[model samples]
Every structure is written in C-alpha cells, then in structure tokens.
Target: MLSGAAAQDSAASATGATPVAGTAASALIGVSVDPSAVPDSTAGAESSGSARRELVSATGSATQPGGDAATATAAVVDGSGASAASAGAAVGARHSASTVGGDSVIPPDSHDTVVILLPEMPAMDAPGALEAAAEFFANPTWLPDLAGVRDCWLVTVGGEQVTSGDPVPHQFHGAVTAGFRCLGMESLGVSFRRVDLAAGQADASRAAALVRAVHVKNEPELALRDGAVYAKRLEIDAVQRGPARDADLAHVVIVGGTGTLGVEFCAHYARSGAGRITLLSRSGETAEVTRRLRPIRALGDTPIIVESCDVTDADAVVELAERQEIPATVLVHAGVNYVRAELAEVTPEKFREMAGSKIYGTEHMLHTWPRTPDCRIVLCSSAAATFGGRGQILYATVNRMLDVLARRLRAAGVDAVAVQWGLWDLEGPLHAVGTGPVQAAGVTPMRAADALAVGFTDHADHSGAENRLVAAADWSDVQALMVAIGQGPLLDDVVAAAAESAVVQPDSPGSGHRDGNSPRIAGTPADGHRGTADSAAYPSGPDRVRATVAQGGTKAMTQFRAAAGQPGAAGGNSANLAERVRRQLGRVMGADADALDPSVPLVALGLDSLQALDFRKRVQVELDRDLPVAAILGGASLDDVVRLMAGSQA
Candidate 1:
C-alpha cells in the first residue's frame, strides 16, 4: 500500500517537486499539467453507483523496465490504469538501463523516449476501471521506471478523457502526469509528451509520424509541427464580437431538433440564410413533430424539414447522413438527456442514459460524417461542464466531453468546435428543466439573441480554436460559487478578463453589463423592477391578479408578517391570497390561471410530489402562511389548502 508520504509526493510532482519517501507537503500542487479526457462509453460500473472509494486502497506497485516485477496488485477502476489481473504478470517492456536511485545509462543511438498509451477498463471487466484508477493512484510504481528516461510520451487516445473535472477522472490524469513527475522523471532528463489520438487516427501513418515528430518545448508546453497545443490560454480572449457573419451553411443538420432551443437555432440559421435546415429527433409521431416544427414554420420560407431520428443510434445516424441530398456542411449537436439529482440519487442506468446523447451521440456523429471535406460539427455544451453545479455531476461530465471531443477533432485536422454556453434565456429541453436550479444559484441567464450571436458569430468564426467558454456573469458571483464547489484553482486568466469586462456600470443606459465591448442583457432588468411590479403590465388574464413578485419580496414579507403579525393589504389577505396560490399553481401546471378549477387535484395537472413541494414552498413564503409541509400532500387541491389556512387562522 502507498504511504501518506507517497500521496504528498504525487501532489508535489504535479507542482514539479521531488518526491521524498515520507514528507509533508513542502511544495504547492499545481493544477493538472495536461488536460484530462472524459470517461469512455463503457457499461456503467458497479462502483460508480456506490459511495466513492479512496484511491489509496486501490494502490499497488508497477514494475520498472530493468527492475524485478513488483507484481502490481491493484485493479483498474477508471480509465487511467489497467487491471493487474487482466494485464497478466508482465509489467512494462524493458528499454534502456536505469537505477532506482535515479541514474541513467543510454546508448548513443537510441530513441531517447518511451511512448505509453493510457489504457482504459473494458466494460465487462471486474473491479472496474475506477477501482483500477484507485489502485494506480494508491501506489503508481511504474512512475519510478521513468527515473532515467530522456522523455516520456503519455498518449491519451480518446478526446473524452482530456478535459474532465470529475474527481475520479481528474485523479487518474493527475496520477499519470504529476504522479510520474514526482517520481523524479524530470530529474532523469525526461520531458513530457501529451499525444492526443485525435479523431481515432491512431491507425493512420500520418498520426504515427506526428507522434514521433513531437518535441517538448523549454517551457511547460509541447508542440506538434510548430502548432502549440490548444488550451484555455490560447483561445480565452479570442471570442469574435460584431454582426453575424454570413456563414456558408448551405445545408445544416440539428440533432435533438424537437426541443425549444433546436427551433430557436433553426430560426437563427434561417435568418442567417442557411439554405436547407433539417431537424432530427427520436419522436416520429406526427403531433409531436408538428409541435416541434411550429416555431420553425413561423420563420418565413426557409425549407425546414423535421425527421424522426435518434442520434445515439450509430446505424440510424449513418443512414440519415448518407441519404442527405446536399452534403451537410454543418452539423449542430444539441442532443442531451438532462437529469438533475444528487450524487446518491443517481443510478448506473441513469448515468448511462445521461451520457448517451452527448458522449455516444457525438462519437457516432463524428464516425458517421461523410467523407466530403469542409464539413464541420458544432457541439452545444453547457457551463455546467466548467463550474459544475449541485445535482449536475453527470450533466457536467457529459458536457465536458464535448469540449474534449472538439480538441481531439481539431488535433486530427477536422473542422469542429465545442461552445460551452452559460444559462440561456431561451428555454431549451435541458434549460427548461435546469433553469430553476441555475437561477437559485446566481448565474445570470444570457439572452436568446445574444446566445445565438455568441455561438454562430463569435465562436463559429474562430474555426482554429477548439473549446470556447461563453458565460455572462459577475466575476465575484462566479468566484464565490466556484469556491463553494472547490474549483477555484481551475479558474484561469480568461475568467479574470471576463470578470473585468463585466463590471457593472450603474450609469450605463441598459441594465445589462458589457462582455468585453459588447453589451449583454443582464438576468435582472435595468430598472430593478424585475418582480411583480414589472410583471403587472404583462398580466395574462382578465383578473390581472398575478404579477411576478419581485425577487426577495416574498421572503421579506414572510419574515415581517410572521414575526410581527402585522395585517397586510386586503389583496394579501387569505381570500385573495388563495386566488394568488391558485394562479401560481396554474402557472406550474401549465394551465390558464383564471380557468383553473381550485377543487381539482394538482396531481391531475401533472404535478408529482416533488413538484408539489416546490409549489407549496412558493405559496408559504409568498403569503406568509404557517402551512404544514404535507398540506399539499394526498389529494389536496388549491381549495383544500386555502381552507386549511383559514382554519388555522380561526
């Protein structure tokens, strides 16, 4: 088993420090040296479903090239390491001579470097890749093998594994890069080579040549044919701002086209003069397809076709792409399976389902692309990939893969980009479900037009760049959230630049802050009239009774009235309060406020228990009523709750 000192050494290596046998942290551990990749599309491991296991328990030693085999005993739990059982008794292959004390003996005519492809766990394997990852991290004995090597090339094959922030994946990448560095690999004149097998080009001769030709720079960077590796530093300040470019997207295809954001994209493209836009979704039913197409049809005479298609199905995607009359010049991957739940609530199947549309779907799309050149794929990733919000671990992981995939694609000479968007004002399928939680946190929602402009105009123009993180939020707020979630160090200079540009100009005409030089609409209105007062003008029904309560108004009133028992306005009394409750319920239930029958069970209006709880909390705070949590449980309706409040008052 690895000692605590070894863990400290691994951490120190990440920061370019020498690993001592037993030492407290004497040096700072830097952020991951190389970007990480997302987990592959393997079957859900049993360990992923259970509580996370410590990496130290999985520790085992690996054999060096010249040394006796230590018989590494740990099993692979994540994608970073291999299982000793599956790998057989043999360890790494022997090369040049080296000693445990960090001395080297190399012949005059040798390659001077060793390249190792990071192995992943097969889906059917036991103790899983995650377990293997734990074991690898626990000991990482092979790190000592690089003691005397001139250089080491750690080839990461899948793009998905390159930029992951999830704990297991992050630990695996750290163990490989920093773990090796701490083992005194650098002391032996070893330089690091991160060979990304872009677009599955490993079998191609050109790819092999590219790997052989890589040379490490004097700094902490690597190079391939003079082109620097793509990182946030390279493209962080590269967002193009101005009018939308007339992109030559004669034929554009959108996956997950039946959602609201899909239709919005179709509208934006139609306005941008896309020749023919085809939307693909799994639901082939006529009514569902028609509902999805309604907004697209509203966008004047552009030919918008709706077809039933599943992006996750490789054969179906290939067949559809093959049959397109005009070769698809652009493909937009907007497909996602959104599920927001706590870590403990997530099941292995749910994890797989969440990953299907983004991971498997993007992979299939890339593989099934027509051989025709100039074709580009644009993946719509989310900010969750970066900041990682509560109950969104799986969603964040999936989005992160999009960014990594773009990196791999570009490295492989493909025209691709992944745009990591913040919360958008236009409610897409994922947005519709996730907006509540996002707002509860403090991220400002980006406007629809601005969002489209950022994606199509800003990011699309920068074809050379791989990943673009686009979000309009206060730097302080974002920093606070990141700090709360333990991801502060990941924030780069780009975030600082964005934060500086987004400083609130109270004197500015519009309430929205400027991103760089361009002004973006802030989530809250400029006049500070975001609540019921502003909503009063846009009242939907004849009664005109439901105005949006300004944010925090309800909470303030609840505290005041609950503590002091002060009588409020007549409209705030129980009678009108009941009407307000019914109206809010109607909004949640997707029914007309004036037309809703207060006697009917809210469950009949599509509210489950959790949703009902959400509604109940809103009412309790808004009206300052001392309502029991279960008041809305069982067959309770608006009238039942109103009567209960009245009875409590008497």
Candidate 2:
C-alpha cells in the first residue's frame, strides 16, 4: 500500500517531469489533452478561458477534499480565449477513469500530463509492481504543456501470467485493454505495450530501451538478455511434425469422450500409438461418438472403452478410478455443457449445468487421482473464457476456473495444463451452424488433431507454465473478427482500440502474415500427415476460401450456366432474373427458396454484417454483376436485388 504521493514522487524522479501542483499529475496512469491548450515555450503565453479534459469520462465517484464530488469535464478554447470543440467527435467512448482506480481528469483549467512507467524488478515482484505502477499512473494531472503530447506505456508482466495456457491471463489483459482503449478513444494519445516476462526480470537499461521503443511508436513485448532489451515477437510454428513412433501415451482417459473435442483427442492419441483409451461420460452410446471413432479405428487395433460415468458425481468418479486396472498416462478433460443467455436470462440452474462438467468435473477427477507426476492432465478451456463471447457469462466464468485450477495443480507439482482454444473445425453445435461464424471472428478452426497435437507438445515441453492460450490468428485480429462474427455493437470500442494499436505497431510481425503466396490454415494435413512430404500445405479459413475461389473461375461459370437455364437464354428478363436472385439469396440464407418472400429486406431475414459481406461476394460470383451493399441490406427486397443485378449486366 504505497501512498499516492510517494509513488508520484518516484515517477517524477524517474521520468524527469516536474511534480507540479501536489499529486494532481501523480495518478496519471494515462491522460489525453489537446496540445493547443498548452502554450509553446518559445512563444508568449496566451490565456484561454477554456480548459482541456481527461482522456476518458470520470465517474465522479472519488470525492474532493471538502466532501463534494469532483466534476470531470474540460472546456475547449482557441488562442483568442473562446470555447470550441478542440478535438471533436474523434474521441472514443467516454468512460469514468475513476472506475479503474484512477482519479478524475483535472479541472478543465489545469496543466501538465505525466506518463508513469513501471519500475525495474525481478520476475516474482513484476505482477505486484505492475499493479502498483497502474495505481501510480492513476494520479490526476492536467498540464497545458502536455495537452498536445501523445505517448505509450510499456508494462512488463509475468510470462506465467500470460502463457499459462489459460483464459485467466487473457481475461485480465482483455479488461485492461478495454479501459486503455476508452482512454485512447477520448483522444488521450495514449497506447500500451505489455511485455511478457517469460525470460525473467529486466534491468533499468532494458526498461529504458522499451520506453524508447514506445516513443518511436513501436509497442512490442520486450525481454531482457545479456543486459539488453529485445522485442519479443509472437510466432506460431504450425508445421505439423511426424507422429511419434514411441508415443508417451499408453492408457489414455478422456472425460466427455463423446463430445467433439474429446473424440479428436482420442483420435490423436490413437494415432500416436495409444493402446487403450477409456471414454468417460454420462452417456456412452451416441452417434457422434460412433462417427468420430472411425478415424481412430483406422489408425490401429486400439480398443476404445466407452464407460457411462457422470464426472460431476465425485463418488462415481472415485469408484470408476478404483475399478480401472491401468493408471491413465494422459488425462484429457474435454467435457462441457453449452449455455448461451444474457446475464439476466441466465438462471442459477443453467449456470450449475454448465459449471458441473467444467469446474466440478475437474475437481472430482483431481480429487480421485490426487497428484501423479507422470500423468499429464489437459483441460480444454475456451477462448470465450477470455473474450467472454456474446451471451455466455456462465461459460466464461466456469472456464476461467479451469485456468486457476491449472495454476494450483502446477504449484503442487502435478503435471497439468489448461489450453484456451479457438473454435474447432467441423465439430459439435458449431459444425451444424457452419464455420463461417467463428472464422468471421478471425479465429481459424484448428483441425481436432492439430489442436490436440499442440496439447501434447504443451504436456511434453513442460513450458513450466500451467496455462497456455493458442489461436489461429494474430491477437490483434481477434477484435475485428469478433465484430464481423456479430459482436459488433458489443465490442465497438474494443475494435477501435485494436485498430489504433495496429496503427501504432506497423512494423511488428503478426501471426497471420502470409508466409508466401498461400496462407497456412491450422490443422490441415502437414508434412507428417498421411505420409505426405511437408511440402503439401493448404491455408485454412478465409485464406483457404480465397484460394479456392481464385481457382474456381471455370467452375463458377459452369454453375452459373446451369443455374440460369431457360431464363438465362431469354435475354435476361427482369422477372426471370428476380426469381433466380430469390433462389440464390435463399441458398445463402439457409432457407427454402419457395418460402422466402420477394419483398422482404435481407437484413430482416438474418443477414448480419459478416453475412452481408458473404452475400455480396456470392452475388458477385453467381450473377456476374457487382451490386452495392446498400441495395441488399438497407430495406432492399429480393426484387430490388434482382433489378440491381439486371441493371449491372445491362
């Protein structure tokens, strides 16, 4: 509990900014002000009645010294002392900085903006220091001189905090990012650089180097080595390796073996030479279980045991473990019940149903087995646990507990890791809805085997981190992908922040950067799959889709001709064209062509922003004519779309 004054003083000495007006400039974890408010040192000072405001709106929760709530607002003024909107609507969403434990923005008339930096410390102290540093940054400061200056802050945190392969760290980062973005949207000219301290503690010199990077508008995660700071780049080595001849897996126990991810895990281990896999779940006989077992059966004579066991029942789990003759070498917990509802709509019963398998199930297994150092326990968590997918509050909460459990088990010397995974390819409920929705959020579905391969690597590498988060796309793309996937209104501010951060780090290499002519898709057969050479590779998701479309020109034309039929031969009549357009639209809508009304807007028929983009692309290909998006989504009926298509051809 360091006092606000002492921390501000430490920051002032470190940054060399004058500690003017007491602690007014102390709580500046971040601040934004119009530069014009502060007079130039070379020019004579001009007094403007107006004052600059905080980077974000203040909650006015923190009271003033005299018992009144402080108002947070800034008056804009030009050189002539007249009020104006200095930086107009460009400011992002205005939120109370006070909510983040930071003070309100200085009264419109104050001057000075101070940027606080985290102090150099060892790996253990880094998390605490980071929390302290953010508090130090919370001191409110308003400087006319700083009104125009924009800057970035680099906060180095624990590698375990990030790479523990869990959603907890991701969730922490997501919330902090959301707050910082609100500041940026307020035109505070502030940005963030989070350096993962995976390598270890950094010295002052290295910290200074990071500052220099931020000053240059390059916000990269930095690490210290040999007394020098180096940028930590994010890379995905997705090149599939050859299956192990002597796989470490033998007797594998898969919880929820009938579920999508669980079956994939079994298949992966089966290919890796597993002799026996016991599938534990409430129900053993399921069509999904039967279908997914085909690939596993093809790999070898491995016997798959489907046992009826409810993981949530501790007594059942204990009894089942006692009856098992072979101790499980690898344990895969992939059981989860899906639930989607708004916070208010979610009842406690529904929450318990989702939490039973994720939280209670893991608890039961760990209690039943205790600590077996040789056994590698893998928990399949979700990306939604971090990003908190739309209408999935309970899911995120329970999944987060999995990451915490991993840490606790790791602390006790158990070999366990929780993986925060993106959507899986052609699996479960998502498979029924199609992959477009998840891909729209910028996540490429990792083929089931590929994801499990990463899990095996995690268990083997013992990266020392208990949690690891893996995704197919760069982290930056996630926000946009979420928007495209239909979380636009929910994540509008988040998307804006992500886009600005992208602008700040133009030179940083992204995970999704094309390696060559083709983008690599996760889980596609790599060099080792099917005994093929490593050379045969294909990209996944949109990149894969793009490549297929590029090579389908002749095929597209053939399909178009078949679709056109007699109407196409009748010189493109408007009525015939409208009928054809209706059919095409119906196909995209996943509806019956005859059931769709010709005069209804596509938007009303469930055409979202991402769906609209696809609709446009499909119409362009099928009709051989490009139609304006407005004519499709903006109250445009089927007949209207047809007219537009016909006019383009003419």
Candidate 3:
C-alpha cells in the first residue's frame, strides 16, 4: 500500500489553547477521555488537568530517508465504556475471517469523527490544489489553522520496507487499486479528499458525488465503490414542491401496470410530476382502459407512453431501452400468479404455469437485458413469501426471490426492490373478486386499469408508516386521476391512519424487526412504509416473515443438502437433540396448552419426521439456528429430532 507521512502540529489548536507542561489533552488517542472534564466539544469528553492547554507548534518534519506519500490520519471519539471494549476491537470480532476467508469489515460507528490527511500535492495545479487543500480541512477531526496554529509539515513516510519493481507507462489517472486504473486522462497529478454527509438517501448520494468529483478531477484511479460507480440519481418527483431538481423525478415504469399496486405507483409518480411515465404490459390496450389518463398524454407532452411488451421477451426489452434515451426509470415486477395448493399435493406443471410469467419472465428481463444505471426496480412480492401459505409454496418462493434481487443489483450500480404487497380485492386477480377471503381481508382491489394508473402516477406522502404497508384506497384514486400532488399535503395523517390499520401487532415480538441478511423488509423502506414504531396498531403486527418457508436465500441453498449428505459435518448439534422437539410442537401448532419438557416423547408432542423437518427449517429462519435437514426427516421422533435441531445453536 502507498503510504505518506508528514509532521504538522495543529492537533491542540482546536482544543487545549496552549498545553502547559502540567496539563494533558483529554483523549491521547481517544480511548479514555472523561466526557465531564471538558466543557467544549474540542476539549473532548474530558481530561484530568487543571490549567487549560493551548495549541503549540508541535509537529516534527521528517524528510524521506527515501519516499512514500500516502498520508494516513486516524482520529477517534471515545465513548465511556469498559476498558477491554474501549482499548481496541472487540475480542473475537476482529479475526481476519470469522466467516472464513473474507476480510474483517468494521461496522458503522457513531463515534467516528472525521480525520483529514493532506499530502504535499505535486506542483503546477496551484490555484486548484490550494482550493482542494482548503476544502479538505472541513474534517471535524483536525483543529484548524484559523482557530490558531502555525505552518504545517513537509514530511515523507518513514520506517517502511521499499520494493523495486517494473516501471510502467503513465496513465491519465493514477492507479486506483492494485490492478485497476482510472482511465480519465485529465485527473493525473492532482489532489483529492473524501467527505461525510447526513445519513439518508439524499445525502448519501450527495457524498458519493463529492468523492467521485475528486477522483475524476484528479484523474486518479479509485477503489470501485469509492468512486462514480456508486452514483444514485435523485429526481425532483414533480409531486414534491421542493427547489431541488433530483434525478428520481425522471421517468418510471410499472410492469403489472393494470394491477392494484401498479396503479398506485402511477398515481404517485403523476402527482409528483415525474418528468415522464411509461406503463409496460403484454398489450397496449390494457393501458388505454382509464379515462383520466387521456390528459396525462398531453401534460405539455411529458410522454406517458403505454407500450405493449411481454416481460418474458428479453431481446425486445433491450430494444425498447436502446430506443428510448431516458430508459425505464422504475420497473416493478408485480405481475405474478397467486395459486393455492398444499405442499404435498402440488404438481410440477402447476408451479411452472403460475411462476412462468414472473420467475422466468423477470429472469429474462434482468439477465438478458439488464437495466439502466439510473433506473429503480420495484418487484411486487407477497406476504405469502413470509407467512408460508401452505397451499402457496411455489408462489411464495418466486416472490421471495424478487425481494432479494436488490442487494444483488446494488453492487452492479442498479437498485432492485421487492415489495410484499397484500392481496388486492379478490376480484382484482387470483381469487374470485367477491370471495369471502377477499372481503374479510378488507383490501380494496383497484381494477387492472386503476392499479396501473394509481401506482404509476401518485406522489403521496411517505411519512408516519412503520412497515411500508399502503391501505388507504384514497391515494389509489388520486393516483389514477393525477390529482392532488405535493410533498403529500396530509401525508403524515394519512400514513399514520394507513399504518395504524395495516399493522398486525405494533408491539408483538416479531414487529418492526430487522435482519441484515434478509430482504423481507430491506432497503430504504418504500415511500408508503415509513420505517418507525408500529405502536398501538394491530398488536399482532404482520406475522413475523421469519416464520415463513423462506427468508435467508443463499444462506440455505440447495448445496447445503448435498454438503451434509457427503460426510462428517452432517452430525447434528448434540445440545439441540431434546429441546427442539418441544418447541417445534408448541410453536408450530400455536398450542398454548402447557409447558412441555424437551424429554417428552415424540408421540406426546406430535411427531412425524416430515413435520419435524419442516419445523427445523422454520426454526432456522425465525431464529438463526442451523439443524441438519435430514435430522427431522429420517424416522427421528419429535423429541429425538428436536434434540438434534435444538442443540445449543438453537
């Protein structure tokens, strides 16, 4: 790694005025500063001295006995904690690969004060370089010169091994990482620095742009995520009456354009004055069903195109994108088949038929055509993905896959969103429209045209929601009509109302929970799902998706089955053997009967290996326990199987 060293003393300028031989700085390097000692933020948490220490010219400049100019600055804000925890990293957490070969990554920290390191930039850029240096000082860490200090350092890295290697041709930008180089020719021989921003979607994008600017300006090669690759456009969303002209306000597309959720999205975009809109479907006629949309065609000719396109045709999709300059800004995969069938009785053909339009369809869309960088994808998933509707296993599995596509696309510079939509009015699609299940569920299913119009046009409020569930069919209407836009005028109230009714149990054990590996409720919760406490709402809250047929996708791949069947690692956890059986029966059956002991016989708790295996999988998803899949399936009684799965890992 290229490194830099320099001697400049301004550390005390911002805190201790001028250090007296008797006074010491609060935190030498952060670990032990008593917060109460110092009154100001600079003096930091606190110190153990009487006289106020002031800044002094304390830097010692070292000329390179040789050379390396990678300036490294490390600053930390220490919180009062146990000595063991404060001194260094947590004991076991810093292992190079707790999960095996991957490098140890640091979790986001609250006490991370900014640290700025400036190297003696090469000459010739003069004005720009000085400006860069001044801006770089914005770091909260360093005590600034204006706050009172003197000249800085002309230093070079010391005490490091030197390597002699081949000389290569000069590129426009300096080497970004070891193997990569920034191809920008103008960035060579310049200086740069990175900055932090408020923690939110808007600000994060801004910060990313700032860092990218420096890399591009300096013509230096940068680490992948550290540069332009992370660009995220923030559009104006005309519905919002803000001065900002963000990129998010650009064009957006809805796939299942005629469905309940699809229309709502349209309304939001229309109300927000999204610059343009497109509703994609298997047929163009589906787009012409709504009357209010006739005016949308003119909106000063904003171009709300209704195109006939089969999602399954990957080649045609690529053609559609190449034909349009703006690209499909937001594509939702809401087109799905909601079939009901028990796990034991379902036929393979039925699974294929229902899922073909979405699974194979979406795969064709993403893999064959891919998406534009600025586009945002919204795939409509279902609660069944989490609730495990016995008859809808195949359907749920397909939906679960969509929810997770976001992370997979993130690294590639695209965003994917899988939203678990509640069932629309029965008549809306799958179930017969007027059915009791649809009626009791209280869902207002918009017609195919209404769904497309609403989802494509509305720019309603997003605040006050806890789980991103949208219930008020009011916005559904507004969306279809392209009426009442703004940063959601009565947004909070509406969101609060919708949230109150939608939540199952705001305080239940499974409510408002989050797991890093699971996308069931991931990303920046949707505009409707304001991530907050779902208090006083339905007490049960949506049943924890954790108890579903699937939650962790790659974590429980089919390969795990083959791995266990192969050899030694297959032995089940001994501690789990007894305890699991009791829990499985009690939990799965919703049996509040009595306190069952782990030692109880399989018959007593309700045995059967098939059920046991199913129970074990649910256990792993709900609680991060790993039980051999076979342990419960191979004739092991409930108690025996539970014992195997419930080992200490449970």
Candidate 4:
C-alpha cells in the first residue's frame, strides 16, 4: 500500500496531470488523498459556485448521498476551479446534507468525465484494495452524478516487476481488474481500462500514449513494458517433453504436515532418502496427526520431528527456523485451508482464512528460512490456479500468488518451483464435494504416487520455468469442454493430439463405437459398453431413462439404448416425456422427482457439468434424438429442456 503523498504523486505521474501548488491533481482525478495531507491554506479555501454549494449543501454530513455524485462532482468542476481538497471536502460534507429544495441538482453538461487512478499495491492487498476502490468510485454519495463519468482507468503498477521476475503479484490484480471491468461496463456503462505502468518510468508522455492505445483498441488490460505498451493475452502451449530427473531430497521441512498432501509429500521424500524430516502443523502431536504420520515414519529410518506451529504467524515460523539445529535442504509449503463456495457466497472472513493459510504461510516460511542457493522451495499449488474450477476463485487466486512468489524466489537465485497439481485420487476436499464436476472438466484424478512422481520429475529442471502444471487429463474431453466454453483455441495442440491419437487407435477406450449411435463427448466413462446378449431383460421407456440415469455416464446410455429396441420408446407422449426427464434429472441429482421444480435450471438444483453430460446422453438414448451439451449446462430449465426433447421427437 502506498502512502497518501506517494499515491497522489504516482497517480499524477501516470495520468500526466500536473499537480497544483498545494492541492494534488491526483486527488481530483479519484486517487484517495488524506485530508491532512492538504495544506491548511488550501484546505481552508471555501468551495465556490452553485454546483459546489449545491453538492455540499445537498448532503448535510459526511455520509454517502443517495444520488449521482459523479454528475454533482463534475458540476463543481464546471462551475469553478475549486481545488481538489475543497471539492472533496464539499462532497464529503454532503453525506448528511439533504437536497436544498428537494429537487436534484442537474449538471450543466452530462458529458463531463472523471478519471480514477488506482495506485500501486501489493498483490495480497488486491481483494481489499479493489473493494475499497469500487466503493469509492461507485458509491452514490461520492458519485451522485454517475452519468457524468464515462470512462474509468484503474492505474496498476508492476509491468516491469512481473517481466523481471520480481515478486510483485499481478494475478490477483488481473482477476480483480477483470471483475471491475465487467461491473463497470455492465452496471455503470463505463469503459474501463486496467493500465499497467512500469516502475520508475511513469513519464507523462509514455502514460498518455499508453492510455491512448488502450482507449483506441478498447483493451481491458494493457501494460507498459520497456517503454512499449502491450495488451495482455492468455495463451496455452501443449508441448510433449520428457520429465527431468528428480532432485535430491535430503533434509526436508513440510508445512501443513498433518494434511493429506503434506503427509504424502513427507512419505515420498522419506522414500527418496531424506535424511531428516520436520513436520510443522497447528495440530502438533495429536492422535490423529500421529496416526497419519505413522506410515510415513515406517517408510524409512529417516529422523522425523513433529512440531506444532502455525505458518501464518511470522514469529512462530522465525522461532522454529532459528531453533532448528539442522537446516532443511528443501522446504515444501503445502499449507492450504480449503473453502468451496461461489464468489458471491464466499464471506470475507472465509477468504481471509483460506488466503492466510497459503499466502501468509508461504511469505512467513520463505522470509524466515535460511536463504541459500542450494536450498529448494516447493510450493504446492493446484490446477485451479491455472484452469479455474467452479466455486474456487479464492483458492485459485492464492495458488496463483504462490506461483508468482516461486518465480520471485527463483529470480532471486533460490531453487524454488511451484507445482500446479491436478486432482489427486484421495479422500480430500474434491472428493467431499463429489469430484463429478471436476471430472466432467476432463481432469483425470491422479493417484498420489503418480502425481508426486510427475511433479518431482517435471519440476526437477526449472532452469527455464518457475511453475509447471502436472496433471492427468483426457485431451478429448478437455478439448470438448474448452470448445464449449469458447476457449478452444487455447488447446489447439491438445485437440490436434486427440484427433491424431484417435486416427492411430480406432478402438481406444471411451472412443465412439462402430455404430453411429454413440457420439463422443465429455464425461464418457473410460470403458465403452458392448451390447449384451439378453437385451429383452433390460427395462424400456421412462423406466429405462430412470434406470440409466441412476447408473450414470455414457455406458448407462449405451446399455439402456441397446435394450430398448427403438431408442424413441420413451417419446410416446409429452406428459410421459416430461415425467421421464424430471425423474432422470432427479435421479442424477439425488433429489425427489416430485419435489424438483421444473422452472429451475438443472445447475441450480445441483446438476454439475459431468452429470449434465450424462443426463444429455440418457435423454438422447431414450428419446432417439440429439441433445446439445449446452442446453443442459447452459442454464436451460427443466421445462425448456422437456420442450426441446419433445420437439426433437417430432
């Protein structure tokens, strides 16, 4: 967080605004300035003009006024050249003031514009900083005349730092900027640009040119790097390369050592000839912790120490590091407090707790650990950081922060690597939520051993990279999901590989059968079902749909379709079709068919992506018609889906 004076100066420099003698121009342009920072002579200047008086007198106190503050602020500027402090004070004073005559003051010109410049802040401060920024810019009291403001520029600093491998966190900044851009465009009808200025290079001409480029191109994110402005784009490369040899693991320290992944890491390192292993966790030496660590202890005769320490606490980490007689050669920061909830549903407290466990824990561990070029730091991040999963925004953000931290450490000559791992086939958070949604996204859950092996090998040689994504994925399913989400271009190579492999192996598992009935899509079961001899023994019609839905996936669809002579057996009548659809959906969602609301989207009733694919397949098989994957997962209600199915039968 920048000091008030520094923030004002930085904002002014970035916007090419010449600062007044006593009043900062940046404050007028929307960067927050401390009232105390203003000179007494300038602060004492009475706000002049009808616009200023109306704005100040409209609200009697320093509280948010009910209407368009932006228009009112613009009117003040139009009416008189009142200093920023005076304007701010007048606006601040209006919080308690009521309308002078109960008629809202109208600005002389609605075209008046306001430019908001957000100063540089640490990456961890992004969430709170953005919230504060949003409140300031969008607040009714601050901008009662919101219509007057047409453009918003969030001035973010750190383009050079990111390129130079400095630890300046930009992922969170980008995410927050994206959110604000959407909000500004949709809610405020404001054109928003996240302008990144390089450090020590915020000249007026460069800043002006960058802003012009961004405005002209309508780019949401633009960065000034090495005096050249560039638009930020996300791209993915699918490269096939052999893994590097595993690194030596002699003396190791595992944070969050009692957690599932932590224990797995300890066991793997122990097996890999780690001489001494120290486990740090808040749980300390509880019976549960001991039970979890017993197997790892038996893995080898490695000396293991279990200690209670919260990695989030700086003092605890420093004390532990100082107390250790034998310094660790490798530090594995695997700490994470998982919370699964939609972005809107996540409470600030929950976000803090989750972020604290990883972000703060990593900072504390890194800063306190003895720094040596020979030492290795392994940050256990998740695939969510790379490919965001549903209800894991905060999870992804923190993991991304770790990735940045690893790069920063690596740039500082430390052997640090961040491993963005996929879902492990273990009883962890994903399992608790039912891994159907993630599996539907085409990520195959890797066994812990396999995951560790890949991670260790891939990250062993990080001379060219600080982060590596290691996960088992079904490329075909992955490609389908990416295409559905309009990000097919990112995985062009993966799609090509999937197509090439299909041509090479026509009879591959999960591939479409010789019959044209089975269309290859996401969430297909690994094994394709072959027709049974006793076809007549199977159920038919709505009963068949219900049975197949309960059975789950493409295999169920295949078996039921083969049994029901003609797949359209269930399409006898509209009422029968509706009932079958409801029952089938209910079965997949573990809900009661009678209780399910037909007007609600399937996703609202807990139908995840994978289940949606399965449900679509079942419907196609039962009704003998094709169902687009989008109709099921794209928030189409039950009634809408039923109508589509009925129309397809016609």
Better of 1 and 2 by lDDT: 1
TM-score of 2: 0.46
lDDT of 2 by residue, 1-650 (tens): 00110000000000001111111010000000001122223211111101221111122122212223222222111221111121121011121111111233334224212222232233222123224323322322311233533332324333223221221222232223212322321221222233332233333323333222222222223322222233321111212223333434668888988777777677767766687888997988677767778777888899898998998898998888888888887788988566654433546566566667776687788778433457778787765644454445555555655664564555556767677666655557545646565554344554444344444432222323234444333222343223232222222222222222111011223212233322222222222111111111221322221100001122223333434452352345787767766776777789898998777777667765445545644554556544444345345777777776565455
lDDT of 3: 0.32
lDDT of 4 by residue, 1-650 (tens): 01111111010000011111211111000011111111224222111100110111112221222323232222222121212333343234433211111133445345333333333445444335334333332332322244544444455555223232233444444344433332331222344445566554443434333323333223334454443444332211111112333555567888987778888888877866788888899978888878877887888799888999988889988888888887767888877567765534546555566677677677777778664557788888776654555566556655656665665565567777777777776777668768777766555565564355445532333233335555545433443344333223333422332222211012344332233322112121112211111111121222211000001122323333433444533536778878877877777677888999999877678776567655654555555544444455555789988787666455
**Per-residue lDDT of candidate 1, residues 315-395 (tens digit):** 898888788778778888877568664433545555556667776777777778553477778888776655555466456
Ten-residue stretch with the least lDDT total in model 1: 7-16
What C-alpha RMSD separates each model from the true structure? 20.3, 18.8, 24.0, 18.6
lDDT of every predicted structure (CA atoms): 0.43, 0.41, 0.32, 0.47
Model 2: residue 107 alpha-carbon error in angstroms: 20
lDDT of 3 at 345: 39
- Model 4 bad stretches (over 4 Å): 1-248, 286-295, 460-465, 475-489, 502-611, 616-650
Question: Which residue window of length 10 is worst by lDDT in model 4?
Answer: 7-16
Error of 1 at 167 (Å): 23
Order of the predicted models by lDDT, top scorer first: 4, 1, 2, 3
Would you estimate the TM-scores of all the predictions? 0.47, 0.46, 0.34, 0.55
Clashes of each: 24, 30, 77, 20
Q: 225 in model 2: Cα distance from truth in Å?
A: 21
Scored by lDDT, model 2 comes in at: 0.41
Model 3 alpha-carbon drift over 4 Å, by segment:
1-247, 286-292, 295-301, 368-371, 411-413, 433-435, 438-650
lDDT score for residue 498 of model 1: 28
